[model samples]
Target chain A: MKLMVSVKRVVDYNVRIQVKPDGSGVVTDGVKMSMNPFDEIAMEEALRIKEAGNAEEIIAVTIGEQKAQEQLRTALAMGADRAIHVEVDEDIQPLTAARVLKALADKEQPGMVLLGKQAIDDDQGQTGQMLAALWDRPQATFASKVDLDGQKAKVTREVDAGLETIEVDLPAVVTTDLRLNEPRYVKLPDIMKAKKKPIDTTSLADLGVEAAPGLKVTNTAPPPERQGGKKVESVDELVSELKNRGLI
Target chain B: MAKVLLIADHDGENLNPTTPKAVACAADFSPEALDVAVFVSGDNGVADQAAKLDGVSRVLRIDNPANEHCLAAMLAPQIVKMAADYTHVLVAGSTFGKDLMARVAALLGVLQVSDIMKVESDYVFQRPIYAGNAITTVEAPSDQVLCGTVRAASYQAAGEGNSASVEDISVDAELPDHTRFVSVETHKSDRPDLQTAPRVVSGGRGVGSGENFDIIYKLADKINAGVGASRAAVDAGYVPNDMQVGQTGKIIAPELYIAVGISGAIQHWAGIKDAGTIVAINKDEEAPIFEVADLGLVADLFDAVPELEQKLG
Candidate 1:
């Protein structure tokens, strides 16, 4: 069986994102860009599945600018067998991205597709499920644990109330949550080896998909800042302050 | 006038409070434009609960056995079938809502406006991105049906005084047999729910080992508050991941939030930024949590929690 993992290049998790002063977009210039943390987890899970003999090949794919190949190279270093870069210049929304992935899936016919539940940049957790819907395949999202059987995969998902387990057949889509697995650090030797790995570049037209803006962002602004408050000398002072504010 | 259809979120017996809050969000539109729909497997009392929400014109109950487990594949097609009659389809931004709406939007060939914090008009809305660091206002094209999930914490639950008529609708959708429901392990607790609680007491790496969380729980019990843990604590196995409070975790906005030993990271602050009054207690005076805390105390949680519990008692 073959596994396809989707990786996204996003603003690093540590950086404090600033909205553009003109309210046009976020300030990405001069900011550190890294593979989305959750996608790294998904890639780790895919590597483990291969090591466990459940999968024969792991393909890492990304849909973004030329710089996104940096993330695909990182995935290749982390253990993906090959990389596919769907090169696009503009910002693609979730729906259109899913369409591009659907085209790839139709061509590759991988046994399984893995993706991060959401991207940290847009926080849109839609692509995986939308791809599943478009492909008319089963989807197990927010997966914390995955066990592959002969032709079935059991997924444990982190839900609102608690954990829910579900089973889906092969040729399904699985989205990773935070606790799936701690991604392995890319070793120096692995980084050197990744340079030789094949990365195929394709365009939206080649995938037979259109780059359309499904959701329009009319305005962008910073969130309202919370005002700072005073310090209390002691626990008694804290209690009195709570009482004074009628919060107790 | 535009008609809005709200998919109710609930378990077998009781309705999730977020459903009512989503209804409240729908109320932002015309007064008599909202319709609540409950889809359940058996004759669960959920339809009755959906009818009690204020401003609902009617409640549509769709009964089908496949609807029992809240499977997104089974629910999405049914919702898409019903969505053609309404201008907007709304649901809460819970896990169930996010999953179901994404599939529905895909089947309909549209985009889902997720976690909308404010509804500017029937077509325009505001949502947080970059983990709540920035707010983006978006508008759906008028030519297409608007589908989105409401941030339940941003709105109050719709009142229950009004009595709306319940209509039984028959739904027939070809649900795929590839997906099967297994068991669910829900953390059963008697404490107030973390999302809707009036007050929340959260601990961080300062709480130490998993067993040491008892101190935080003891204080929470005294104050009748829900217990929450920072991502560090959850990652350290001090608590379940569901108890984590941060940008990727549960977003909460309680009336009072007491932080114990939490060196506030920006991700954690994003979840609690909407909290009414924040109080931080950490031994380090320079911990970032103090910047937004209404009351800051530079004391060890071990000694401070016990003393504070006694004072509250």
Candidate 2:
């Protein structure tokens, strides 16, 4: 069985994103970029499945500009056997991205697909489920724990109500949540080895998928800023303030 | 005339409060728009509650044992079949909604607008990004069927005076057989739900241990506030992950949010930024939580929490 892990390059989780002056988009120039934190967890899970003898190969796939190859290299260093980069210059929405992945999935014929539950950048959390729909496969999203038993995988999903454990047959899609696993640090030796791995580059035209974004961004702005309040000296002062504001 | 379909979120017994809030968002589009609520579950009682929601024109019930669990694969095809008559499909921005809508959008060959906070027009919407620091307005093409998830926290629930007519619908679409529900482990709490609670009292790692959370709980109990925890607290085994309030956790916009011993990381602040009045109780005055707090008290939570609880009582 083969595992195809989807990774995305996003603004580092620690950086405070600043919207462009003209409200076009967030300022990405000179800012730090890393593989999305959740995608890294997904890659780690794929590597674990491969090590446990459940999967024979791990292929990391990413869709973005040429610079996104950096994230694919990181995924390779994290233990993916190979990499696939779908080069696209413009912004691709979730549905189009899912279509492109579905095309590649058709070609690769992987037994399972893994992805992060949501990207920190767009926060859409749609691609994995959308891809599963396009491929007509089962989807177990927000998975905290995964156990592969023969042709079936038991996934523990983190839902709003609580944890739900579901069993999905093979050839399914799984999205990783935060508690899935701690991603291992990439070693210096592995980084050098990853550079030698093969990365196949393809264009959207090659996949026969058009970049049709269903939603358009009309405007962007900063959220209303909250003003800081004065510090109280004692519990009595706090009580008085609460009373004055009718908060208690 | 626009025809809108709302997918109801519910437990096996009752409907979740977020379902009515999503209906409120759909109602904002047009007063004359035909709003229909779809209850896809094995229980007919869920559909009975859906008929009582205000603003809906009717309730469509698709009762089947396979629809018992909210599996995205099993529900998306059924929804797509029913979606041909509707112009828009909307759901609450809960985990179940997000999961199901994404698949439905894909099957319809359209994109899903997620976590919509404001409905500027029938096609335009405002949504938060970068957690909550930035707001972006999005416009969907008018030609395609628009599908979206409404941010229930940002809207008021629709009134319950309406008695929409109920219609039984049979699903002929073949259900996906790959996914099967095994079991569920839910965190049952007697207090108000954190997302819908008017007031919330959250503890962080500074609260120390799981046992020490009693002080935080006592304060919450006194004010009839829901109990929440920071990701650090959840990671430290102080509380369940469902109680975590942060970017990766549940985003809440309560009337009043009290931060007890919380340092207020950016992720935590993202979830509480929409809160009306933020009160911070931490020994470290320099804690980032004070930056956005409506009232800051620089004191040990161990001392202040008990005193605050007593004073409120």
TM-score of each: 0.99, 0.98
What does candidate 1's lDDT look like per residue over B155-257, in tens digits? 8889999889999999777778999999999899999999889899999999999999999999999989999999999988999889999898999889999
Q: Each model's C-alpha lDDT?
A: 0.91, 0.90
Candidate 2 lDDT tens digits, A1-248: 99999999999999999999899989998999999999999999999999998999999999999999999999999999999999998778988889988998999998899999999998888999999999998899999999999999999999988999999998989999999999999999999999999999998999999876667887779888889888888888888888888888
Chain A accuracy as TM-score for every candidate: 0.98, 0.98
Candidate 1: stretches off by over 4 Å: none
Could you give candidate 1's per-residue lDDT for residues A29-93 as a string of tens digits?
99999999999999999999999999999999999999999999999999999999999888898
So what's the TM-score on candidate 2?
A: 0.98
Worst 10 residues of 2 chain A by lDDT: A211-220
Candidate 2, Cα interface RMSD? 1.0
Clashing pairs in model 1, backbone N/Cα/C closer than 3 A: none
